[model samples]
Target: MMRMFLAAAPAVLLALSSAQAEPVAYEFDLSHTEVSASWVHQGYSRQSLQFTDFDGTLDLDLETPANSTVDITFNLISGIWAGAHHEAFVGHLNSGDFFDTAVSPTAHFVGTSFETEDGETGVMTGDLTMNGQTHPVSLEVTLNNSGETRDGRSKLGFTATGTLLRSQWDMGYAVPYVSDEIDLFISTEMAVPAPAE
Candidate 1:
């Protein structure tokens, strides 16, 4: 019994250690960033779009870096295409042909799994929901940078990209000139928690 107790000691201690530290929460910096998307419209020409706001929470445990997860929620109805394309782009995007924002006002992405493919580059599998439809997708992510600055501040940043079939979510409206491929882009910057005061 003493030997069994000794063998179980480390496992029990690790569990206690994990339970003591809470997940780190970080807010993204939007000012120094852009959230944009592109898709082929005429098989050769590409069209681009961007959203105005992104609100979400990210939870990470530096010890188990691969176990981190991020929840991002964005306003679909507030998206802007930025040009003379506003009228047709917004109208059609909000219509049944694209996002159908009238039926779904928001889009959400929640991380599920992480995998490494190359040196410091990886993939994050998650569920992406838009226009009342949800689908499992993976994003190619690269850990651009992570470290502490001279100001006693810690930081981490990454950029992710993915492509999804528009028709998978019922966005099949194409005038024979539009494409069904949608390119997604995500960039994030995070800092450590505030010091105890």
Candidate 2:
């Protein structure tokens, strides 16, 4: 009897463990998403108030928290400056002078690595594609929280900021007014989801 009980112990443990497990998934609801870029001009800084669209996806594992990633997309054509009424500004920004949004209407960020610092804040290394140029961009990230809700939705929220030089990406424009330093501000609330079918 002792030998038989020992033999069945492993199987019993596995069954109990499997029975107690519940699947957890979180998603990013892009409707609550925000993506913006800003640059200094002379002595003042201004931000672009418009974007065509933004899309993102986050797959998180709470147990294995380190195995997570962020994928973000931006619509260059949707950038609105001057309340979107400045045709010259829009024309200049899209005409290879700055963004060249006509040729490349979208930009993307894919995080390849992450490191935490001072608790929840840290840096994320990723590829940021803009103006048809790909560069390794490091951005400061802040992860607020993540959890499963009563509505059967698991979600995550975060804020990320980064700075870039316009001249590096051939995005240089602005004569003596606008500064070369560009800052990106992104606040996101995302749902956990697999790829779209």
Candidate 3:
């Protein structure tokens, strides 16, 4: 009996180790990702701009969602306005009145914590740095789908929405007219890199 108990100890330890899965690394599939910002334009309509150039990574732990993390960066210089007078509008947006790309060329977000009752949805809290200012922001995040590709690569998709006041970041050029509140919309697909031979 004593010998049998000792032999089982090693197997138990091995099983415990295998159960503790490590977080999987995933890179954003830019082709399937979109990050946009919208704000009310003088109550006439809501104006929107897209972040054309950006990159992000996710460390996902399916067994322990709280242990997951994400980091993203946006190139403000790549901001685009989809509207009439496109060039002029984009130029103004990049000027000092708005994002001021010359001064702060990039905005970054680092997720600090994620809270959820179920693994499919959660509130992600992170520090967002923009226009030389960093503030805490929370996004309602949803895991849309996750599966394995035909090539055996893992893939997952998510959608997130949040709102922030432009004034909080000191980019309030037109408060009453342009609407100080800014709404954020993000959709992204992430995938594990193909294994190298």
Candidate 4:
């Protein structure tokens, strides 16, 4: 019995080491992150707005991409409308009819599952909460680059796009006039934090 236990010890240790390689944690580089949305304005043209402040986390499993996940929180009050009618449009966006940022100041997204389309393209299904309401949303994502930076930190960059109806989240201020369908896009770079001492 002692000989059998000793012979299996090496194999057990190897298995544990391999398992530890999964699910590498990463932090978003906020300086390079951008989340923007756009929709048709009375069918004349499309208007775009960007969320200026936000943070998020990403857990990536390169070997098993399906096991990855992501979570993000965006400040609803940070919406910026860079248009000729900037102040007026921005105020309308923040008023009770639109985002109602005064009452619900934050929006969130938490990924539940991930699926790969090819090597670097994938889809993430998650729950999105906005205007005090939550609903499921799937974002199409693509890994544009992944490598080590000059400082030796591992980094990954991606762009994601998703479409959702504003009315579904109770932000339907003007359905046909402003367009209920919202096209959202996110471009972000993430880095693996240094290991602790």
| lDDT, candidates in the order shown | 0.60, 0.55, 0.66, 0.65
* lDDT string, candidate 4, 1-197, tens digits: 00000011111111112344577777767688766788999999998877776665666665554455566677667645456758887888788887688998877777776655354666667778777889877777776776777789777677777788889888787788989898878777667887787
TM-score per candidate: 0.79, 0.71, 0.84, 0.80
* TM-score attained by model 3: 0.84
Task: Please identify model 2 stretches exceeding 4 Å from their true place.
Answer: 1-26, 63-69, 79-84, 193-197
- Candidate with maximal lDDT: 3
* Candidate 2 per-residue C-alpha lDDT over 123-182 given as tens digits, one digit per residue, 9 for 90 to 100: 767777778887776667676665545565545566777777777778777745787776
- Number of backbone collisions per candidate: 0, 9, 0, 0
Q: Of models 3 and 4, which has the larger lDDT? A: 3
Give the per-residue lDDT of model 1 (tens digit) for 1-197. Answer: 00000011111111112442555665555564556677787888887877766666676654564445567777777755546747866777777667777888777777666666343566667777887788877766666676654666656666777777777877778745787777877565656556768
Candidate 3 deviant stretches above 4 angstroms? 1-20, 79-84
RMSD of each: 10.8, 13.2, 11.8, 11.6
lDDT of 1 at 63: 53
On TM-score, the candidate that comes out on top is 3
Worst ten in a row by lDDT for model 1? 1-10
lDDT of 1: 0.60
